[model samples]
Target: MQETKPQAVSRATDEELLALGRDVLTIEAEAVVALAGRLDGSFVAATRMILGATGRVIVTGVGKSGHIGRKLAATFASTGTPAYFVHAAEAAHGDLGMITAADVVIALSNSGTTAEVLTIAPLIKRHGARLIAITGNPSSALAKLADVHLDATIEREACPLNLAPTASTTAALALGDALAVALLDARGFGPDDFARSHPGGALGRRLLTRVSDVMRTGERIPRVAESASFAEALLEVTRGGMGMTAIVTPDNHAIGIFTDGDLRRLLGAQTDFRGLAVAEVMHRNPRSIAPDALAAEAAATMERARINQILVVDESGLLVGALNTHDLMDAKVI
Candidate 1:
């Protein structure tokens, strides 16, 4: 057998790059997965602690964790949990008043030795509040002092340099999301309740806004007497821009609707437009809705019946209001 020449090593440096990515992914995935197994007594205990709180949740963190803390606090507040973020440094500098005995405190630290976080530990304990810690080090003072410690430790950083905080921050953020969502689910938070809290949102607008909000009442409503000339009704329609006018008797109950559609028919039939009255061309006993119907429901009716303008009358069928598709668009009911 002929002797084979030995292949020399290429001295390529790609192994470290590939291994760093794999190592970080593996550790971060394990951290999140381990959360499921560790979610024993602590998870339930945390939820009960938060739900039982009579005051807000005070979240505190240092450096990179502070950025995540602010977002978490905002999420909780907006979703009805009532929370606020406090910088650990500021907490040591008289900002501790932001927290009270009735509140629950959640502290975040990766190594658990962040000096700023440690400085406030004694105050947190003295406040008689429940302290929950999220950290990578269980033996650290911040973790040891906490009433409940959530382990967010990861084996390695995602950075190739392994100096910058990456996987650790990701693990902490994911854990925060898990905690918030779990609490939200336990509280049975829902859309209707959410809309109440966010009344400026679209869902709230649809639920809270009534037909009266967008209706044109009094002088803005286009109305014509049955005795009025077709020319007079056309003037009302042109002024109101609703493309229609309500035909009412002297008592003010809507008896018919005179529309642009009626105008087309009247003209095509070559009626003596100069002598015709609105009563001759108006649609008799046209459909009308009460002023109390939901704007969303009214919009639906308009779409289903192919009507652009609807007269808003009372239970007695008195023409008190008017609305068009443009009103729905302006109100965002569409």
Candidate 2:
């Protein structure tokens, strides 16, 4: 057969394109907003069912609903609820075995008549698993069979032809997110728990990293005895390159801190350079944090005190390490 060339259509003006984009967003936004009003006891019941389940949440759908299901499953799993997506069509072809009596199945279908999802809905229930259906039609067979039906009905699709799934899918996704957030709150999921699931992310670095992990220790720390001359402390500061030096006692307990800022202020006030004790100009009772404290806490302390450097001290107040804003930045803890 000979192939025929396609005819070209007229291009849309920029104004027309912008208007269409705005319309789509408005429609989808309205659909999601409408869902908030429809939510009743059924929403709470679904959350309680999932919370009480001993097994995982099995999210299943097809087409655009499947895409939403995959995202919802990931959101659920990351936010303390154990969940995973299973394609409805695949569920019929041996994947149904993945569901169990203890599991709670969440099925997504805008029309609530998707054959692929309906085919395995009975088997899912027969396995003793409870079904939570999200659909546009409450009277559809799938919704009728569900233990709890979440109405996702929308006035119209965002698509110009009103055929493609758009507003409906967005509403379904927003509903799923609401469910997941409810479960997270119920389980008291916190930032620390979230950090554990996302250790490679910035929040993980801030929450999991400790002061000792990024502090300058040993010879890297700039230190001077209380009896040291101002010149000697300046030498240690320049050599350590931390822009500051810790003033310590004979037992190495931090007593004060001297920084480049203090040096500038002193130079402005007095020009005597022959003999000056670091103890005379050093800031006494410097802010310090424990080595085991979180690096984020260190950052907070520095920001609150408006200081660039802080000393890390042990239980006995002995200087163990030192860190500045630069070190926190290097570790990406801030």
TM-score of 1: 0.63
lDDT of 1 at 272: 80
Q: Which stretches of candidate 2 lie over 4 Å from their true place?
A: 1-10, 268-271
- Estimated TM-score per prediction? 0.63, 0.91
Query: What is candidate 1's lDDT per residue for 122-172, written digit by digit as tens?
Result: 898899888999898889889899988888887777776877888788888
CA error at residue 87 for candidate 1, angstroms: 0.9
lDDT of 1 at 285: 91
| Model 1 worst lDDT run, 10 consecutive residues | 34-43
Model 2, residue 210: C-alpha shift (Å): 1.6
* Model 1 misplacement above 4 A: 1-41, 136-144, 149-210, 224-235, 246-319, 328-334
TM-score of 2: 0.91
Q: Write the per-residue lDDT of candidate 2 for residues 22-47, one digit (tens) a residue.
A: 99999999999999999999999999
